[model samples]
Target: MPYGEAMLTIARELVDKIVAHGRADHPDEACGVIAGPVGSDRPERFIPMENAERSPTFYRFDSMEQFRVWREMDDRDEEPVVIYHSHTATEAYPSRTDVSYASEPNAHYVLVSTASEDDVEFRSYRIVEGVITEEPVKIVEAYG
Candidate 1:
């Protein structure tokens, strides 16, 4: 996906994994990264991270764990294609804090809302320079 007209093309399995993580975390926010080949917009690796805050409304990745994950991704020559977090009670939208912490301009910011037991809302956005632009998500069985 391009910059202006961005789209998050992810796998169904990855989506399921994210949803499961969100559900398992319950009232707390869950966060993770989907890594892929650097420059390849496809998400291939699911790297769930611990939410250091452990709060229902806010999420902050565990710093030490994040360091290790980044090192592993560097060794694998991968980049965070999607940075995801769950909202326990709110809609699948980025919070002000989330937007302020948007460090990966090229990564898709995916939000999964686990507010309802019956349904889940998954959304993707491009947060660049503090401006968030919601994008379309296309979940496929797998990448070619």
Candidate 2:
């Protein structure tokens, strides 16, 4: 099926994994991609990527690592269904740079905020042509 046709349903475990990665890199943004079978619209593989910039206010995938990951995904006939990152001191929303750098119009852009000491705000959006549209995220125990 085509992407963005339905609400994104992510496994709870995957959500935890993303949150854990964010917490682990607290004070600095964490970035990664979840790959799924091409056209599946299902995020099934959690692939944590190294943030080249390693800045709390910025994130950039390591060029070599990204190339390798993309090549692997291509070999597996998969694509990035979800592109995610963390915001250490900001809201779980895309920054202007994020929107500008968004090249995956078919991928869900997920943002996690580790700014709150008591709560973590996780949100998802579709950034197409520089337009950001918030989408509902349904967390499930598993995905079949």
Candidate 3:
């Protein structure tokens, strides 16, 4: 499938999990990946990754940890369907750095904003060739 062709459907529980992680790591960005069976387009596994940068305005996955996680996903015949991170003080939108760092053209880039304190701003986008295109996100009860 192409990068911007399909609407991303994420389980509500998974959304909750992501939001919770964002809140837990408030003031610092939290990063993670959602792995699913290849070609499935259904995110099934939520693997919260450590923010190596640990900075409020930036996030970088730990090198060794990212390698291990990707290796594990490969071994399980899975791929990262969604690459997610939190925006501590900004809106739920990708920053210039985020666009430059996005290497997965086919993965949905989800950004959660914990800026509101009382509200969670969740949004998804597709970043390809440094261009960001917002996509619709459908929260479902479960993936079948």
Cα-based lDDT at residue 121, candidate 2: 96
Task: Please state every model's RMSD to the true fold in angstroms.
Answer: 1.6, 1.4, 1.2
Note the Cα lDDT for every prediction shown.
0.91, 0.93, 0.91
lDDT of 3 by residue, 55-135 (tens): 999999999999999999999999999999999998999999999899987799999999997889999998889889899
Clashing pairs in 1: none
Clashing residue pairs in candidate 3, if any? none
Candidate that would win on lDDT: 2
User: Which has the higher TM-score value, candidate number 1 or candidate number 3?
Assistant: 3
Residue 22 lDDT (model 2):
98
For candidate 3, the lDDT comes to: 0.91
Cα lDDT tens digits, model 2, 50-137, are: 9999899999999999999999999999999999999999999999999999999889999999999888999999998988888899
lDDT of 1 by residue, 1-144 (tens): 244347888899999999999999989999999999988888899999999998988888889999999999999999899999999999999989999999998799999999999999999999888888998999898777
* lDDT of the structure predicted as candidate 2: 0.93
Off by over 4 Å in 3: 1-5
Model 1 ranges with Cα > 4 A deviation: 1-5
